[model samples]
Target: MKSSILASAAILAASLEPVAALSEPLQNILINTDRSPIYRYPTDVTRGIIPIPVHSHNDYWRDVPFYTALSAGCISIEADVFLFNDTLYVGHEESALTKERTLQSLYIEPLMSVLKKTNPKSPFVSGPTRHGVFDASSGQTLYLWIDVKNNGEKAWPHIIKALQPLRDANYLTKVQNNETFVPGPVTVIGTGGTPLSQVVSAADRDYFYDGPLKDLTGFTSLVSPIASTSLMEVVGDIKSDSENPLNPTQLEAIRKQIKAAKDKSIGVRYWETPGWPIRLRNELWRMLWKEGVALLNADDVNAAKEYF
Candidate 1:
């Protein structure tokens, strides 16, 4: 009887091995990008069933509760860097400052540790496999959407200098001609009425211009024609109003804009949409997906993961 029991136990363990191997242990995964956190929901109303613990953002990095939402494999991550004095800190705006929350401490340090463990030879030793989109031999390429929150002329040089190490390693994506102006690896995405024409012309680097959906017609026609080889990311800042719960008109406008941009082979993203609140997010996603938008930026990763 003891011999029989031992054999049975061994057989059970062997049977379960494949299941265990197939299950990917969640370790800081993001659906589209690695910058945001993943959250979990008890039930998914849209799917008519409970999901396997959807991943979403948790402010746990800020002494908030650790949410159980699993990661949905984020391809890229965005970190907004503000250079104060000589230090670069990660925050969306200038007001949210804290001594312990420097860019290295908050975003770079932890991310580097993760990358080192996963892919030891990564150029970004501070964060490994975080941005898995680029070739390893080419070095890890991070979009590094550096929003020039400060003085563009002064701050731009400093930002480039700071990230010079990565550029030397060929980890940066650069435009053919404008190497001097728009430095490598870091794509300058402007916000709050930033004039990108001079920047694009001077640096010969591609950029993301934030404007209304309709306003994109002129910009795309003007910029894209001359810079045929250049890339442009048009970001539409749309919001929901009382009259429109999901902003159907804005969605339609975005669709048209994306179609036009695609014809030119440019990228697009819609910002300022409600990130959480499952119903609203799903609706927005459904619209964007239908329009064939490749990238979806979300403040919360888990909310975005549900649709996928």
Candidate 2:
């Protein structure tokens, strides 16, 4: 019986060797050949990436604005736009602004181009599709935070005008009849110096306002899908050395603001978080996630991506 068992094991092992030998060469040929059976979808650019709830704070500061955040699987992006001669220029401040890098050049056009590729006019597709930038989650609407600088009333109009191409493509999310909401590939949110009166007054607008995190009296997801505020401002200085980074008072403040936003179905994001003392940063991130903060404001998406 022992001899028969040994013979059976030997036969099984011998059979597996031929299959292993065949697989390696086939894999190599597939890797080298153009005729490989692997097929890709229209928006396979972000095929393997998993979308995370991190907001890429000051996204224009990155080497490649939109593409960098998109590649890192960041669902939110912020751009500081300064209106100059009716052209919306993207920069952190007036000194950084240049003629070459307008909102159209940096964000609007690039997003349109990507959307065009994703929503290809192919016979295989049944109808018009509004697939977003992330192929992993086609329905995820990217938050495009436009921080209007200086003249908001003036910049606001130019920002709207610059979004024409995306508007034409039906890519901007809309709130029709001041009530009915329609989700699209991109959700343009007005922050910084953006005029609240202008945003709320519009009976039918494609854009939204970045509501105050602490105050959500009249704002809802209709006007502000996501609300934001500085963590330092709201919670005071975080004492990171201890087990509980945030003191009792600071934790309560955060919870109150988050609860207010949650009550109105609005997402919450806190910026100006401490980036130093790696341990503190990680601890804060963990606490925020545990406490149900909708989006994590991350200056370093690479680190945030790894943390998630």
Candidate 3:
């Protein structure tokens, strides 16, 4: 009887047709909850979703793909892309791939929708102003980190082609005359096996390369807006029991890596941060944030929000 009631409620919500496409969980929530207090339109709910500095790692695996991260106020999100039969499938593993969850459908469409609502055609504004992802603060650009799981050179063209809607709408951050960078609603950074030569050689490209955090003396902000390295690799090992975790050597290495990235006018991020031994994990997170890391890459964004 309860299942029938929820089913009937879901059908009713679907029939009404909310302004934005409802994710599976959201539809279920609407089905179960009282409709009186719910927002009339789905887009109305996004107005309250503020953008945060945290990055959502493995974002596609979540219940609602993009909406899950956005609802958590994550300004940065990652998508692991695999090329299969000339189509980009968004998934963590090969077995998880699906026909319906293409990069275009899961990321591009939803992004375009949100951006359209955020940056509406208005007469009040002047020539042009860059709009960010959040309704609360529209100046901060959302970083779309694309981790190419296969041949990046072969996959580059497809990714560029997929960004057509954003490109057409002038939503991508662009480098002016190979010198000045203008941050827009979305800044796509290609990482993990993405070729540096291809990224650097593109004289007129919207996408930027993720520079190596350990080797950042060569590149500047124009080509690489962000630099990243493995936390474990950098610091050697992290101990949960110790209060004074990082020794002199480890501290120096971290400072140098961070300084190198900062000196180039670029942002820095570290992956695979310690997760267990809760106290030490929090301490490590604090150390990174305090040292001026641009985006704190976190698999668990809720914990990150609280860490901040």
Give each model a TM-score: 0.55, 0.88, 0.83
**Roughly what TM-score does model 3 have, to 2 decimal places?**
0.83
| RMSD of each predicted structure | 12.7, 5.0, 11.3
Tens digits of per-residue lDDT for model 3, 1-308: 99999999999999899577779997988787756656444235467666777889889988888887887888899999988888999998889999999999999999998887777666888755557668777887889989999888888889989999999999999877677777788999998867788888877789999888888767888888888989899989777788867777887898988888888888888898877777887888787888889888887778877775
Relative to the true structure, how large is the alpha-carbon lDDT of every model? 0.45, 0.89, 0.84
* Model 1 poorest 10 in a row by lDDT: 224-233
What does candidate 2's lDDT look like per residue over 1-308, in tens digits?
99999999999999878554467877887777655435446566678878899999889999899888888899999999988777888999999998998888889988998888778788987888898988879899899999998799878988888889999889989999999999999999999999999899998999999989978888889999999899999988788788789988888888999998999999999999988788888899988888789899898898999998
Q: Candidate 1 vs candidate 2: which has greater TM-score? A: 2
After superposing candidate 3 on the true structure, give the runs of residues whose Cα lies further than 4 Å from its correct spot. Answer: 1-45, 126-129
Per-residue C-alpha lDDT of model 1 across residues 1-308, encoded as one tens digit per residue = 99999999999999878654333435334443345434532112112212221222222233321112213333334445567787766566778766666655654444333333333344535653222222222232333344556666565555555555444443344455543333333333444324464445644444444433434455542233211110113333434433334355655555666777677655555554566455656666676667765456555655566567
TM-score of 1: 0.55
Estimate the overall C-alpha local distance difference test score of candidate 2: 0.89
Ranking by TM-score: 2, 3, 1
